[model samples]
Target: MPRPPYLGWLAATLVGLFAFVIRMLRLGEPGEIYFDETYYAKDAFGLRTYGVEHETVENADALLAQGNHDIWTGTGDFVVHPPMGKWMIALGDYLWGLLPFGAAMSPTGWRVAAAVVGALSVVLLVRLALRMTRSVLLAASAGLVLALDGLHFTMSRIAMVDIFLMFWVLAGFTCLVVDRDRMRERIADLTAAGQHAAGWLGFRGWRLAAGLCFGMACATKWSALFYLAAFGLLTVAWDYGARRSAGQRGVPGRWLLFDAIPAFFATVGVAFVVYLASWIGWFTSPIGWGRHWAAENVTGIWARLPEPVLAVVNPLRSLVHYHAEMMNFHTGLSSSHDYASRPWEWIIMRTPVAFFYNGDETTCGAANCSRAILAIGSPAVWWLSIAACLVMIGWWVTYRDWRAGAVLLGVAAGWLPWFTYPERTMFVFYALPMLPFLALAIVLALGLLMGRDADDPQYSPRRRIVGGVGYGVVMLLIVANFLFFYPVLSAQIIPYEQWADRMWFDTWIYGSSGSG
Candidate 1:
């Protein structure tokens, strides 16, 4: 293998460090549970203290503020989501004495895990870009753009599961990208040696790693299943491409048996096992919601099973039932929420969620002061990314550029499924998992702007300068856009009119609606 890119890590580390500091700054200032943190934060506390979610008192948030963390009623709460994310949040609460909710309550502690993961995601994106493009500048640029994206920035600072879900999805994709290169190299070596059959590529480390990451993603949120399916198919396609490139006859047939089938086990099968295991807490806890489901239905063949087999089958069966109910809830959820948004508008961030907001007399030292957390995307980044996606569609169709296909696949995984649930109340934050791919698309587009070394022979220096200028302008606009909205994203108190100025349209509102 060639010498590793030593400078790549250094650049990624610096960008990641910058991201970390930005996310960590004033993280605890809000000091109040916001948006879904109300559910996740309390659920974390429950799991930490009682091994499962326990029902909280009606006024639990108010009580927690008054130093009463003993707000649970000791009854099992039927939480809709899985437990791994809660376990992660619980880790922070466990270390900070907040699980016990003693006199000292640290909101920053609740958000520590998110800050760390969010920073690591930037490093991961940098590595992915470096591997895909083999250009240190373009890779670092991807990391910088991701770091500057307002939605990525805002979500990173808050204690939410979506960022963790994004982390795992990106990690899985990174592993798959590595596996793609590895397989290509192995196939090329075989073809050069006059070997037509590249049989049983020995234990693939990256593919297995991707499986594990996808599992963790599912453990975070069920929506990750869409990604699992999308990436699984992409992996198979890569295998077919590798075989065809190697001059193998009947590439599709050979790849189906030799690659796709094994890949199914490597990714989907492993993910399923990991997902089932994530429910261990629910399985073991006596009062866990739906734990008694199988026992309650002892009427049919379930009654004839031997006690030991019954013991295992019961919980598994019950888990399946719970999933059915959860799916039902998700599909039928049409309740209108003030901050809810449509999937089509998500690309342009037409309706961003308001995670938190407060208006007070003294905070701004003016007639009105507003401190808020709006989950808005950088307008420049989002607008350009939409164009980049369209460009990728053409690139994929005309050139069969694997990079374009990979990115568009990711966007589909994170986005297209939501279109099916159009009637469901969705928030812009649900689109968090797509940001990395959008950044990647922009990177690919940037590569076009700054022509590759191969293209240097064909291009005039004047054209190169124009491309460079265009790239710089977009980056500057992205940074400037992020800075302009940083106040609202970070909950910084500002004069009401100044806050209003940041709202580019009437849709950007405060409180229940989108007006700023």
Candidate 2:
């Protein structure tokens, strides 16, 4: 009933609205498919046309622009990732590209979905920050930081699936936090009711929702499996902690029976079901790549099943076989890329992926012109987050702060897994899914510096003023940094000198400046 919460939501919504409008601005620039859009945008169009993604013919971009929708090469493509994200992108094409509302090949039509998902991420960060920290300032700050990050901005405007992956991972993490709170509350209530153990909290809907979100995340990219696994274990830990706090006897056994078992069914089990369901388009299509693998190569268990059972099981078997092939591709994908970066370098954004660049252009009314879309985070937010992450680790170690551990785990789940594949061709922008956690760490660290509540007489006003001013200055810096790189981030046609000047490091300059 308090006015502050309402004001907080208003601020958050306004920030997200700003993100959406800015992302939508000049979204059709360069007016051609470039980078990974060549793969995803066309695949999205195919998904809209057929039940599955089909291979595209050459000059697909120009063909689509000429209103030629027959770009598919008559067979399904062997895309590694699942169909969930392409389906999301296809929605934008359906609304904007089909009805004379916009050109079929308009960049705006395909990119709108990414923009919307990116903006929604900002809103989710605000809600999450508010949940963790009651202060509206912290919540709004986290949203603003993400809104201004160049990596987020560029990813928001592209048709690539990483933005959807980021959105779903964040959603799942948020849902798990809610589930933690719900489970803890149930424990408190039951323990107060003269009971040593809190029995099963029927079904735990939030955990199930978390599973669905994580399933969508994994369905977007198999890399999301890292977060799904990490978060699944984290939720079980939360359950154990909640039971121990409630003074339950045989807490380990109680947690396993009442919480851990259901948590698994709600998360991992449901996630497997949803992940399998996401491939239905490919599974049903007769000509889909690898759809007949199991039927043709059934050798296990003597292949003794009846035709009906074989028919039913063959689909699932083929899906499993496809996944194995995809995993092989992922592991052996060490093919060199110009913008590839190591996991260590990604900590400081050493090598940002160039999403788009105008290689030979004279459109800026200058001797030389460049238009680019560079994927990099705002330096102020990202650099500050390094210290913030260290701070969170310390808090978790020293005080065993659950909030700090949650933030650290979120970042780790999104990150660390990449390091295991040191030879993998990875780009700095692959770190996108972890940005929300970094923002949370930054805001939380700043909040700690801001002393305790203003109402607490023991809190130092001087420290509060220092932290508040420091936070404001950081916000200003993030905005200024974003503006300075806006031309490169948004693929704006600018003088080559201006674009080069925006390039902070040699790695950035070496990356594509929309020159492709």
Candidate 3:
């Protein structure tokens, strides 16, 4: 089928916007902080009030609602992860005010930012897929699958850092892909003009933009560092491949000189500057903890530096100390929670976290009461994606297809690192970064099922029929699964029996008859 110009972009945007509306509808129903929001929401409020996050009083939610915005004084609170994510949460609080029973602390206000980012991610994925496959249907299919995925939907509706992390990383990936295509076209033009060498590719504005996006990802969560490293290598590899494709024999040395070396500054150096810049609030405010640490220490190496240098060094040192404490917290988080999951079980949605659950038959006006929001993966998409990943492995190793390589790189960058800390408590929601890649893999697998023109002509009709049937069945199953669980996911009141049926495992129950 011939691709329809602009139609795919319009379709993807509509699908993504529809997904956003679904996530945003009646989002404030929960009327209370769910799960980790208790920690994050308060931290956000504290950060806004104190410049640095500070401890809150017991039952701080009630206190904050009572107009006691002074819950956080001048001290810095010990928190895991960086301040940028909390700063985003603070942005919501600033715009909506700190009303506990009002919309400020409501699910809608806290999560609206994440939901918007998640929707934009779908649009970005569609564009990226279209570029990779040169097929509009394949691109729309990838976006459709993600928009329908339960995990993506759930994550988008929560006020969490992971969604933002996924957004920025994926944005960076898209920028890098654009850089590759632009570089390839430029090299082709130079070759056609009989220029043996095209040095430096002048300015690389796209790559620098990617670096800024990647830095934002890191600011949201430390896990984004893995993507930063992987993409750095991947971009350099793209340059080498482009040179070789243009008939340049000495590709490696030339790539090292022209691409890799400059990329280090473009990617890593730019990211460092952006990451530090995200802390402007804390760095500039004298009220923040350790803001005066360097000024007070005027007898050491830091003191020997010029005043201008010390100004920069002081903030860096303070940030380093804060990170050390945060790292310690993450490493030491071993106290068992019923919903805490290991990395191995994340793909299967084992031990999904319950964001909210309330059971009162009288209140619900049901024979058996049920209201919940559980972070569970869409079984059809995730299960098929696993098979698709195996296929990708074969395709990359055998055919050396760049598209397959891209999918694998994206999946590995977001996922493999978690396995290194298997003993550490993690959750299925952490898989957000990998979901786009998984959806892309599924699209590629569907493309394979559609069959190439070079394949046997006699079997082409049968293959297309079978592929369409299979694709239809999977899409129906995924939509049905999402609908079946939608009540619990959206915290709609339902019969207790209905909620129990959705709990597929004993581990999903948290001992208080709650569905998590």
Candidate 4:
């Protein structure tokens, strides 16, 4: 098929924007905090009031809604994650009044940021897929799949950190891809001009941008550290491959000496700096917990340092201690919950958590009522993506495709690390960062099924008809599945019978639909 120049990108953006609008619509309704928002939203409010998270009164949610901002008791709250994600949530509160519309901290405003980021993510995935596959159809298909996926859609509509983590990590990955292409072109141009021998490429601005993105990702969640590490290795490998492709000998050692070490410092080191920078507010505030640690313990190394340097170093030391406490909480968390799930079940979405559920016989217009916001993955998107990943593995091993390698790197970076903490409490929502790569895998698998244009003439007429029909049927089924489950995913009021029917299995009804 002939590609439409930039129309594909424009179309993808429109689709993504539409998806975003749907997520943003009625975002503030169901005024009570949904599920984990109870923790994050309140924490964000605390962070804003005090430099550190403050303890809340019993039944604080109700109290805060009644124009009571003094929920904090001045004691530090023990939170598991870093402050950056909550800071983002606080941005909405900052803009839309400490309590907007007088209906409990505008959920719409808080979630709108996530919705926008999710929409931008769709656009980025589309462009990245297009560059990787050189197929506009595949790129658009990938974006459409993500735009429609229930997991992505629900996360976008909620005030959560995972969405931010997904956005920045994908942004960093996209920047790296752009950097790769630009480096290749520059090397080719220099070689053609015969200006210099192959060695170091000077000051990569794109890579620096990627470093900033990776830093933002880390600030959102420490899980982003895995991606940063994987991407660092992947960049070096790309450099080594580029050198070898250009006929340079000893490319591995050369990459290690000239590219790998410098990239390690530039990417990881820069990321560390940016991550620390995000804590500037807490550092500067005198009331922040542990802010006076240096003053309290003046005989240590921090005391020996100049007062100016101590001002900088002390905050970092406090932050490190805070992180250690957070890490311990994460490691020790083993409390049993009805919705807790194993990583193995995440791939199939066996048990999805219901973030919100409220319905009455009067409101639902049925014997039993059901209104819910389920964090479920679209079966067609995820299940087919699983098959697509198998195809990717085959392509990587049999044909040694670099694109497949890159896609797998994304999957592994976001996924494989979870298995290490099988005993630690984790959620299916953590899979959000890897969903973009799964969408790409699905597109690539479709490309394989569609076959190349050059081979069109060789196929028998019957085979072509069968293949086209099969593809059409699959697409139709996927659309039907999404439509059937839309009410539950969107928190629409429905009869209990209808909701049960849509559940498709007992696990979904039992809050075990691990689809987040």
RMSD of each: 2.4, 2.2, 3.3, 3.2
Candidate 3, 1-516: lDDT as tens digits: 225667777867887888888887877667667778777777777677767767667777776557455666546666677778778777865665554544564456677677777888889898888888777778888888888888888878777778788888999999999998899889989899987566667678899999999999888898999999999999999998888888876777788999999998999988988898877877766666566765776676766789898877777787777777679878877766667787767777666777788886456666779888888888888888889999999999999998899989999888889888866877788888989999999999888887654345555877888888877777788789888888888888888988989887776767222454
TM-score of each: 0.95, 0.96, 0.91, 0.91
Give candidate 4's whole-model lDDT. Answer: 0.79
Candidates ranked by lDDT = 2, 1, 3, 4
For residue 124, model 4's alpha carbon misses the true position, in angstroms, by 1.3
lDDT of 3 at 234: 95
- Tens-place lDDT per residue, model 2, 1-516, is 125568778977998999999998998886777888888988888777777889778787788777677768868888878889999999976777666557655788888899999999999999888888877888888999999998899999999999999999999999999888888887888888878755676668889999999999999998899999999999999989888888888988878888888888999998989998988788778877888889899786828888899988888888888889888988999987888888887778878887777757798899999988888888887888999999999989999999999899889988898989988888887899999999999999988888787688778989989988987888898899899888888878899999878887777867523233
Error of 3 at 330 (Å): 2.4
- Residue-wise C-alpha lDDT for candidate 1, range 1-516, written one tens digit per residue: 213768899889999999999998988869888888888888888887778887888898899877788788857888888888888877865665544532224578778778888999999999999998888888899999999999998888777788899999999999999999998888888889988876766688899899999999999999999999999999988988888777888777778777899999999999988988888878888888788898899878878889999887888888888888888888889997877888898998888887888877366778988898889989898899999999999999999999999999999889999988768988888889989999999989988777756445676676668778988998899999989999999999999988888877767784236554
Cα-lDDT of candidate 3? 0.80
Best-first order by TM-score: 2, 1, 3, 4
The backbone clash count of each candidate, in order, is 5, 4, 1, 6
Candidate 2: RMSD over Cα atoms?
Answer: 2.2
Worst 10-residue lDDT window for candidate 1 reads: 97-106
- Colliding residue pairs in candidate 2: 356-514, 357-514, 357-515, 358-514
Structure candidate 1, residue pairs in collision: 508-514, 509-514, 509-515, 509-516, 510-515
Q: How do the residues 428-453 of candidate 4 rate in per-residue lDDT, one tens digit apiece?
A: 78888999999888888776676654
